[model samples]
Each structure stands twice: as C-alpha cells, then as structure tokens.
Target chain A: MEFLRTLPNNLLIYIIIAHTLFGIGLYDMMFRKTLIGMLISLELMLQGVGINIMSFGTFLNPEPLTARVITLFLVGICAAEAALFLGIAVAVFRNYQTVAFDKLTELRG
Target chain B: MSFETMVVNIYVLSFGILLIQVITGGLIAVLSKSLVHCFIGLVIALIGVAGIYYYLGSPLVAAMQIMIYIGAVCVAIAFGLSLTRKAGEEGLKSPGPRAAIPPTVTLVMLLATLKGLSDRGWINVPHKINEAPVGHMLLREYLLPFEVISILLTIAVIGAVSVALIRGRT
Candidate 1:
C-alpha cells in the first residue's frame, strides 16, 4: 500500500516508535516487582523520550535548542532518580535484610 | 514508483517489525517471572528503541543510546537482578501496572483523540530561523544547565560505584 510505503519514509514513523517505547517502558516501570527491573524500564523510557525530542527537532520543526535542552533535563532527572532510588534500596536492604518491593513496608507506618 | 521507493518500503517493513519487537520486548520484560528473561527483553526493547532513533535522523545519538543505555544501564540492572532470587517465592510477582482508568477505556479515549487530531489541521511555522547543530544551538543558551548535568552524571557514577562496593562487603 502507498500509505504503508510512505509511513516508513516519513519521520513520523520514528516518532510513533519513540512514543510506544515510552509507554511500554513506563508501564513496566510501574508494574515490575524488582527495583532493578523498574530502574531498567525507567531508563528505557527516558531514552525513548530523548529520541522523541531529537526526532521532533530535526524532522518536524528543526529547533535544536528546544529538543537538546529537554534532553539535558531528562539526563538530569534520570541521574537524580537513580541516585535516590539506589540510596533508598540500600537503606531498605540494611533495615529489612531484603530489598524486595513488598518487604519495603517502612512507609506503612 | 521506482527502486528507491522499494528500498524505502523495505525499511518501513523493518521499522514495523522493530516496533512490534519493542512493544513485545517491553511487555515481556515487565511480565516475565525470570529476572534473566526480563533482562533479555529489556535489551531487545533497547535495541529496538535504538533502531527507531536511527530512523529519526541522528545515528550518533541512537548509537549512544545503545552504548549508554543498553550496554551500561542494562548491565547494571543485571547485577541487581542477579542479587534477587526467584520473585514468586518472595511474593514479588509484578504489581500488574495500575491504571486510574482501565486500559480498555484508555484505549478508547486515545482512539477518539487520534480521530480528532487527524481531522483538525495544524499549521507549521512559516520561517526556519534557527537550524543549528544541537551543541551550538543549545550550549550557548543553556550553559549552566548543561554544566549541572555533567556534574550530576559524575555524582551518579560515583554513587552507583559506592553502592555496589558497599553491598560487596556482605
């Protein structure tokens, strides 16, 4: 089909892929049982977003500042997230003798 | 209607396949009981994401995504995954991702929104004033934030190393 052929030729195809990856990664991050699994998925989600921003910049309107700045923000957020989560995970392992998400019941108080 | 179009069609086909691979990979990564399988699925998804990035016009960033995300981050996760035992014994089966609205309802809402977006036309900017390289365009305007980000990355690397070392003691 002409539409099918055109789809890949258009940069929108990449945008759709990026968006889908973002969604699935977020879903996994939210649903996964292990802290590491969630962190991996979160990393995937962030990479997807970076791809989206770059794609939009180069293809849609060509605004490097807009996309690159957003990417920098994403990098910062991911670094912070990783730091906080790992710190908490370590503390949890120390307190409960396990980092199992369910065993992390400190907030239940 | 020529050879180039045919090549483009093949590319599109491949992209479609990668899209499916990514979605399935992500679903499996989150849904699988085995931590190893989760790592495999996550790697697949990361590869697929990188493919999509290639199609987006920057092969460099796409390559970096594979190197930094798939290579480094996933390996780090693998280390963590190896530390944990079977999830089932621990009663740690995935939480199954709560949705404020059910997925089906969300799907329907999304379909309606897509229909509206396709029907309503949007305008593109008339002039193309700024089409500079990413570094030049953003670095000058966003210098402080950029420096802060580098600092953040340094801290995260040091922190992750320290955490892993501390855990190694036990």
Candidate 2:
C-alpha cells in the first residue's frame, strides 16, 4: 500500500503510456493487413511517444526546452512519415491494384 | 482497511483497467484481421494513452494529445484508408515471410536495448523546471520550429495533392 503511493506515480504512468503507444505502432507494422492501417497504428504510437516527451519536459526536466522540442520534431517526422507511406501506398496500389499488403508481390519472381 | 482505503483501491483498479485498454488496444491495432478493426483499436489505445498522459501532469499536452493525435491523426488516416481502397479488404499480398524476420527481430532487439538503457539511467531528468503552457512554449522559445512545422505541413499537403493528381494517369 505504502509502496504503491510512493512509487513515483507520474513516472510509472508516463512510461507505460509511451511504451504502449510504441508497442501499438510496432504491432501494426508486424501484422496489420493494409499499409495505411499499419501507418495509422504507427501514428498512434508516435503520439504516445510525443505525450511522454512533453510530460517529461513539463514535469521531470521542468525547465529545459528539450523534450518539447523533441515532441515537435516527432510531430514533424510523423507527418513526413505519413506522407511517404501514403505515397508508397498509392504507388503500390497503382502497380499492384490492391492495398491488402499480403498479395502484392512483384519482385518475388 | 477503511472505507477511504476501499475507494482508493477502486480508483487504482480503474487505473489498471485503463492500462489494460492501452495494451490491448495496441495489440488489436496490430493483430486485428481487418483495417477498420485496426483503426478502432488505434482509437481505443489513443484514448487510453491520453488518460495516462493526464496522470503524468500535463493536462495541456493531454488535451492536445487527444485533439491532434486521436482526433486529427486518426481521422486523417481513416480518410486515407477510405480514400485508398475498400476498408474490409486484405489487399495485396505482403512482401511476405522473408520480409518478416528483420522487422520482428529489430523490434525485439530495440525494445530490449531500450529497456537496458533505461535501467542504466543515461539521462536523468532534473528535479523541477518551468512548466509553461503550449502557447507560451511555442510563441517564445519554440517559435521557429512551430513555423517550420507549418511549412512542413504545407509541403506535405502539396506533396499529397500532387501525388493524388498524378495517380489518375498521365
């Protein structure tokens, strides 16, 4: 009981949250059926990481502008990643005629 | 042992439930059979993440985490999903079994490395500091990147638009 309250509640919450976000994104990449679906999951994961950064920036570091900066960077990178993936998906759709992800093999001849 | 203690226990239990939602949501997003299911899992996981962020101390980021991330990002991806093709589809066959090992191994190794690194406490955060609002942080010290994000977003918008236009045919 005492230990739970003394457990640095915020740290526990923050760490778990970010990791879960990351795990979701990682999971999607591993198994989801569509490229866009995987990408969407990836975005969720990035948001989790961004939340962790800002929370740390606000509470743990408290003063330095670093974590917040990292969050912005993540957002920018995430947007870029999305665009790249979308473009790839479009190209793949054009070439393969489907977005199912498990059926579009062209280089496997 | 007291009534208050029981109430606290309930609260803690609720927290654990939220944690479960986060973890399971992640799993669902990854393992669900269909794209729409994955998206649904994503939304659930995001909401849970937002709740965890609230527990961490930044309500502002928490709110934005919901608004921009759960709201904007998820909705946008859903639109992309709808726009790309049918939602119920399994779509094209993946690069398949050979392309699988590297990413799986990489994820495992990365998580293990990160866990070890965290244990080492490489970057210890300071005890306390100024916790300003997002507007303050953005308007003052972080203005440049804020502007850059806008430009980046603009470029992405144009890039996506052109890709869509060129997608039709030459």
Which candidate gets the maximum TM-score versus the true structure?
1
Q: Pull out the clashing pairs in model 1.
A: none
Question: B1-170, model 2: which lDDT tens digit per residue?
Answer: 99998877776676678788887887777666677777888788878777665555445445766777666677777777777775457522354575566456546755674665475332333233345655677778788888888788878877876765555534
TM-score of chain B of 2: 0.72
Where model 2 places Cα greater than 4 Å from the true spot, the runs are A6-13, A51-66, A76-80, A87-96, A102-109, B1-11, B86-133, B168-170
Q: What does the lDDT read for residue B120 in candidate 2?
A: 39
Q: Is the docking of candidate 2 incorrect, acceptable, medium or high quality?
A: acceptable
TM-score, candidate 1, is 0.76
| CAPRI tier of model 1 | acceptable
What are the clash counts of all predictions, listed in order? 0, 15
Residue range with the least summed lDDT across 10 consecutive positions in model 2 chain B: B120-129
lDDT of each: 0.63, 0.65
For model 2, what is the alpha-carbon lDDT of residue B170? 44
- State the lDDT of candidate 2 residue by residue for A1-109, as single tens digits: 7766433354545555566566556655665677787687677667666766765565546354567456656766676667756767776677667777657665577
lDDT of 1 at A10: 58
